[model samples]
Target: MQLIDSRYIMASPEVVWAALLNPEVLKDCVPGCESMTGSAEDGFEAVVAQKVGPVSARFTGLVKLSDLDIGKGLTISGEGKGGPAGYAKGGAKVTLEPIEGGTRLSYEVEANVGGKIAQLGSRIIDSFAKKMADTFFERFQTAVEGPAEAEEGTDETQKKGWFKRLIS
Candidate 1:
């Protein structure tokens, strides 16, 4: 499946770029990431657990950063094994552009799955991929720019992500 999306972050391109290479920020922002280690130059190893449709699995993967343009953009690609559940591999081209007050972070992602997971069908897999991409960017934005302004009359505690709310 393929997905494209973008978000405006209230930070400079440099700051956003730094966060993208930060292992702590990535570990915290990735929806189900349990741990991540390594550097942007050497690539990272990550363990993540997630549930998609009726399948649940823990994935161990290696994520690499390439096509570097300094504070401008890069490509992140990775593949993971989920035992019998399936395997997933994908790549995303991320771009950063300075805007009026911050940076416009955009991404185009393409992913493929195999084994039993692919049996779930494209509709289910597509929706899950979209959600994963959305969640990652949302959490990344929050991590870089801090908590979003609480909506009027909305309880601050209603914010998503248990860890994010706790830290905020």
Candidate 2:
């Protein structure tokens, strides 16, 4: 599958970048994440338990950050095995742009899956993936923006633009 999207975060690029590289922040934001360890410079290992439809699996994975440009952008690639459930490998290209009062983050991702999980069909898998992505971004936004801060005004503008593009 391929995914492309963008979000405006109510923080500076530097702050968002720092949060992105922080293992604790990732562990907190990633759905079903049980543990995350290792360094940002040397690829991290993750254990996550996830359930989709009637299937459940525990995935152990290693994620590497490459083609990094610090606060600007990076490439994230990972592979995981879920025993009888399946195996997945994916990569995403992430870019950060400084906006008026915050940062705009964009991503293009490609993923592939196989084994029992692949038997679930594309629609089910895609829907589940979308939900997971939504949850991940929501948590990430909360982590970077914090609870005490005001909601970002840019979010509405961007949403409207996206809707317009979708309808057009």
Candidate 3:
């Protein structure tokens, strides 16, 4: 599978870069992430529990960053095992560009999987991948924006609930 996309973050490149490299931020944003550790210089380890259709697995992987240009770009590669579920390996090249009052982040990622997970079907895996990416970005956006603005921009249905509480 391959994914290529970009997002505009409401922060400076430095702030966005700092959040990207922070394990705590990633752990909070990554879907199904049970744990993540290490650093950009020493490589990072992650454990994630993911499910697709009727198949579920716990993946443990190590990711390394290379050719880093500090607050600009980097190359990432990693592989993970899902025990009896399967194994996956992937790489990505990410670039950050300063845009307007914020930062634009882009990445091109390619990955392959094998074992029982592969047998489940590519469509399922592809959908899961897209969903995971969406969830990650949404969480990252919320984290950077903070909770006050998040609540202010809540959907109408959600706003009604909060309005009732405020009035009560």
Candidate 4:
């Protein structure tokens, strides 16, 4: 499947880029993430636990970051095995563009699933993926902008043209 989305973050590209590369931030923001241990240069081993439909499993996998352009974008690709449950593999291309208020973070994602998880059907998997994206970004935006700013300007952020045109 393929997915695309964009969100306006209330921070500089530099700050956002740093957050994207920070394993601590990623572990906190990403749903079902148990541990992401490694470096950007070498790659990371990730342990994630997630429930999709009727099955719940813990997946241990490797993630790699490449095709990097500093302060702009990068590619993230990984695959995980959930024992007999199934496996998932995907890659995302994320780009950051500076805007009037802050930065526009956009991503194009492609992913696939197999075995029992795939047996749950496409619609279920799609819904799960979208929810994960939204939740992840919500946490990430909150973390980058801080609780005070994130809470204070909800109405204003909605009014921004970039936001209005990008996601909805």
Sort by lDDT, top down from the best: 1, 4, 2, 3
Candidates in order have lDDT scores of: 0.88, 0.80, 0.77, 0.82
Which tens-of-lDDT digit does each residue in 20-45 have in candidate 3?
A: 67677778887889998999789889
Q: Is candidate 2 or candidate 3 better by TM-score?
A: 2
> What is the Cα-based TM-score of model 2?
0.85
Candidate 3, residue 133: the lDDT equals: 70
Worst 10 residues of 4 by lDDT: 159-168
lDDT of 2: 0.80
Candidates sorted by TM-score, best first: 1, 4, 2, 3
**lDDT tens per residue, model 2, 34-128:** 99998889999999899877889999999898998989999888898999999878877889999997899888877778898889999888877
Best by TM-score: 1
Query: What is the C-alpha lDDT profile of model 4 across 1-168, one tens digit per residue?
Result: 788999888777887888778777778887999999998888888999999999998999998999989999998888999999999888789999999878999988888889899999999998887787778887787767655423374654332222222322
TM-score of each: 0.88, 0.85, 0.83, 0.86
Candidate 3 regions exceeding 4 Å error are 147-168
Error of 4 at 61 (Å): 0.5
In order of listing, the candidates' clash counts read 0, 0, 0, 0
